[model samples]
Target: PLMYPCRFNLSTRSIHELAARKAIRSLEGHDLKDVSEYTDHNSEKYKKMVEWIARDLDVSTLRYQTADDMIKAIGRPKENLCLYCWTGECPKSARPKAAITIDIVEVKPDATRTKEIKVEL
Candidate 1:
């Protein structure tokens, strides 16, 4: 199986806080347990723990495609492709400067007649 890293603009701290809250809630009936440690979100240990959890959750949530995979699938060069969806970085040349519209015409041939359809983009 191929593994691709998940990339998005979500906040990791928010996810960690939510998970920590859930953990604390789950330990409500436990006896002699120090659950106060889960509330420390700024510690290095907490950051590492949450990073692993967040990575696992993020990866399990979706199947991601890398920029190389997208380029190969679309048969386009990386320089000419807008890969902002796959990778967070966008090339300056790929940015759109103005809006453009295109019109397309489809022709259908029948036994004794022809039909024309016009489409605008």
Candidate 2:
């Protein structure tokens, strides 16, 4: 649903918009692919990409409320998502982290999904 360091600050709204745009663009054209991956861990090759993201995206408080809006905009196109990006102290970078957790309450096929989701670091 979101990349690593999923936290976002409301101050950087413009940057947040750009990041959402990029995520939407990447997620488009793929069917049945529900996972989002950062795929960049401070690699020499992705340095440019990271720089571009920092320049074009705003994620100061993404995890706050902007992330919810982004996910809402994206909708449920894929079943699961895997986000992988640089997870340390950077600016507006995507990283890999667990988005949601699910526990089986019953062995029924129609078992209910968790009403509240827990994110793990």
Candidate 3:
């Protein structure tokens, strides 16, 4: 199976925390656990994206507050860069699920902005 090494951080906000909590809660009885393989592994692929993220994070002028912050840090708004794809895994394989949840707490795309609401997906 394809594996991803992500750790759950307690410092993130409630929306993201809640989704991870919910996903975790859903797996309450499962034997699943995080499998670590990329131990201190540095490679060209990892370097490429970190550089990309630094650039996009600057261009977006992002100040992140949720999982979306991490997302926008690496991707443009409305762009969903799959976790598997970014890590150089074949996307056709079972996609490793991600715990990062993004809630747009606020956005001012331009000088003229107002309240925006989106239904939960």
Candidate 4:
């Protein structure tokens, strides 16, 4: 998804998008058949490929989001969103984080004109 269409908009995207595109593009001409030949315990070839790509992309740091974090950021219920791309399994329910609250105080030039606001996060 990020190779053809998204790569076309590379310059217009944010740093995060660009990094994602770079990561996807790194696998651009790799032969999946060869990668499949290696056992899961010996993933040196795949690891090296990723390392080379990261270096080529000149990224200071790269991190892949976990399935849980991705779901939380999406905000939608787990049943409503697609997780195949990340987890390869569909979860029936989501474990979202509890809501947070903060208090904000605003003060005007007149000491008497002060307002307190409660913000939910």
lDDT (Cα) of model 1:
0.36
Across residues 1-121, which tens digit of lDDT does each residue of candidate 4 receive? 1111221121223423433345434555532322232212236643554565567769766444444654565554556543433333323332234332221112234641212222222
The TM-score of predicted model 3 comes to 0.21
lDDT of each: 0.36, 0.33, 0.31, 0.37
Q: Rank the candidates by lDDT, best first.
A: 4, 1, 2, 3
* Segments of candidate 1 deviating more than 4 angstroms: 1-62, 95-121
TM-score quality measure for candidate 1:
0.28
lDDT (C-alpha) at residue 70 in model 3: 41
Q: Report the Cα lDDT for residue 65, model 4.
A: 41
Error of 3 at 85 (Å): 20
Between candidates 1 and 2, name the one with more favorable lDDT.
1
Please write out the lDDT profile of model 2 over residues 53-97, one tens digit for every residue. 555556332222233343354453223321221222322122346
- Pitting candidate 1 against candidate 3, the one with the higher lDDT is 1
The predicted structure with the larger TM-score, 1 or 4, is: 4
Best-fitting candidate, scored by TM-score: 4
Worst 10 residues of 2 by lDDT: 83-92
Q: Which stretches of candidate 2 lie over 4 Å from their true place?
A: 1-38, 57-115, 118-121
Candidate 4: where is the Cα deviation over 4 Å?
Answer: 1-30, 33-49, 87-121
Q: Candidate order by TM-score, highest to lowest?
A: 4, 1, 2, 3
Taking the candidates one at a time, how many backbone clashes does each contain? 0, 23, 0, 0
Worst 10 residues of 3 by lDDT: 1-10
In Å, residue 69's CA in model 1 sits off its true spot by 1.1
